[model samples]
Target: MLYGLIICTITVIIMSTVNIGLEFGKLDTEVFLIILKSFPIILIIAMLLEVLVIGRIAEKLVHTFSDNTDGFNAKILFTIFFTVIGMSLIMTVIGGMLGKGISPDSFGSLSHWPRNFSIALFCELLIAQPPARFVMKKLHLRQEDKLDYDFD
Candidate 1:
């Protein structure tokens, strides 16, 4: 919990710093306000993307794995790859498009989108393991082949 707080605080500072030169006062205020107020919306959108977009897509792709071939570890790797790279790229394109018409004074803060998206992707990755297990189990992945999660 303490670590999460520290990380969140640091992220906010980094975001503020990134916006320092890109936008002016009014635009900064507006964009910051929008970010603050609309954060829940963004989070909801990301959640939906995880469920409606990534989850379904991963389900389809994961089915190709044979228990004798691709297993838990492999699926996790592919899911992470597809989720982070694919979603981040999609968000980047969308952000770029949105950036075209309007110049928010704080629009410069968008430099953090990728970073934020990465963080969100990581969170999604963590949540993904349970579903991954379910899928792997359904595929008849055995316990003996499981990778030992050694912290050392």
Candidate 2:
């Protein structure tokens, strides 16, 4: 859960900025203001979508692939893969909708969704995960606590 929150927050921020820049061509003062103003709402929507929708879907995918017997690295890779896919899809749609609401000319079409998705996937896998994992490790949030149960 903590991991999910960290990843979702980081990915949302990066993806939102990148998508905004892609739509507007550059991040000038006006664009930055748009970002600053819209950020809170965007983040809220993203986190809700991630936690309530994507996380459940990713967990189901993960369980289908692994029986909880894989090594930690394998599990992490699976989680990251599923998460990147889930986040990219959800964010692309939501961003497009919000962008359209903000400026019809700027985000006029969904033609750029593929490009946006690729950039998001690449960033999540290559850029975001390393630091997020580091932070989780430092905070002792990476390790799962196993509970032993006995019936007599």
Candidate 3:
């Protein structure tokens, strides 16, 4: 979170400086204020959607598939990961189609392969079989509770 904030601040500062230098102060200030005003709305909409839709759906699915009686926790987690990947792919495509259709050249450069690769690497390193079980034991956590860590 700290890193994200620092990057955002740096980006805003750089963009502001560029705008002031390229355009006049008046135009730059106007655009900056508009962005600032719109940011809160964007954040609120995202948060509300996540809380109302994403959170509820994920919670229901996880609980519905939980290994309460039988010992089939893996099936639940497997479903969760696949669901996440499927949703990510769909969102990427939909987001690519917002105001205007995605430009082929730009979309080619910004495709999701790099992100998927990083996520795969992290999963492999942190949660691949015995290593994960061992880590959980060390942390004094159960496998079911470990699902919570996946989100973190």
Candidate 4:
């Protein structure tokens, strides 16, 4: 639950900010307000989906791909790749639909989802996940079993 919450919060904030900027071409008070208002809705949905869906799938994938003998770097890379792929696909569809419903004029068509998904995946891998892991470690919020991997 803590993992889900942290990831969801970071992912939503970064993705929302970038999407809003892309849509509006500028960040203003009005846009900021819109992002703020939408944050809870997106965050809640993301958290639920992460906990119920993505997290389970990711755990299974990691278990299948990683053994106790696997190096920490290999495990981390596998986990991140699985997470980015799963979350990107799910969030792109959800975000695109919500964006269209919320402001049809601002969001482009579904055909643009590939680009959006790529950007989100890139941001998650490069920006959000590392910082989130650091924060979780500092706060002692990470589960020992889930995060622990043999560094050797």
Whichever of 2 and 3 has more TM-score, that candidate is: 2
Q: Which lDDT tens digits does candidate 4 get at residues 19-60?
A: 777878999999899899989998988887777887678879
How far is each candidate from the true structure, as Cα RMSD in Å?
10.6, 5.4, 12.4, 6.3
Per-residue lDDT value at 75 in model 2: 76
| Models sorted by lDDT, best on top | 4, 2, 1, 3
With a 3 Å backbone cut-off (N, CA, C), the pairs that clash in candidate 3 are none
Candidate 2: residue 96 Cα off by (Å): 1.3
**Model 2 clash tally, residue pairs:** 0
| Model 4 global lDDT (CA atoms, 0 to 1) | 0.75
Model 1 alpha-carbon miss at residue 3, Å:
18
Q: What TM-score number comes out for model 2?
A: 0.77
Give one clash count per candidate, in the order shown. 2, 0, 0, 0
**Best to worst by TM-score, what's the order?**
2, 4, 1, 3
Give the candidate number with the greatest TM-score. Answer: 2
lDDT of 2 by residue, 89-140 (tens): 6666667778775565435445666776787678778777777778888766
* lDDT by residue for model 3 (78-125), tens: 544544444334333433343136776435423754464344334433
Residue 83 local lDDT, model 2: 70
* TM per candidate: 0.43, 0.77, 0.32, 0.73
Model 1 residue runs over 4 Å out of place are 1-34, 65-68, 97-152
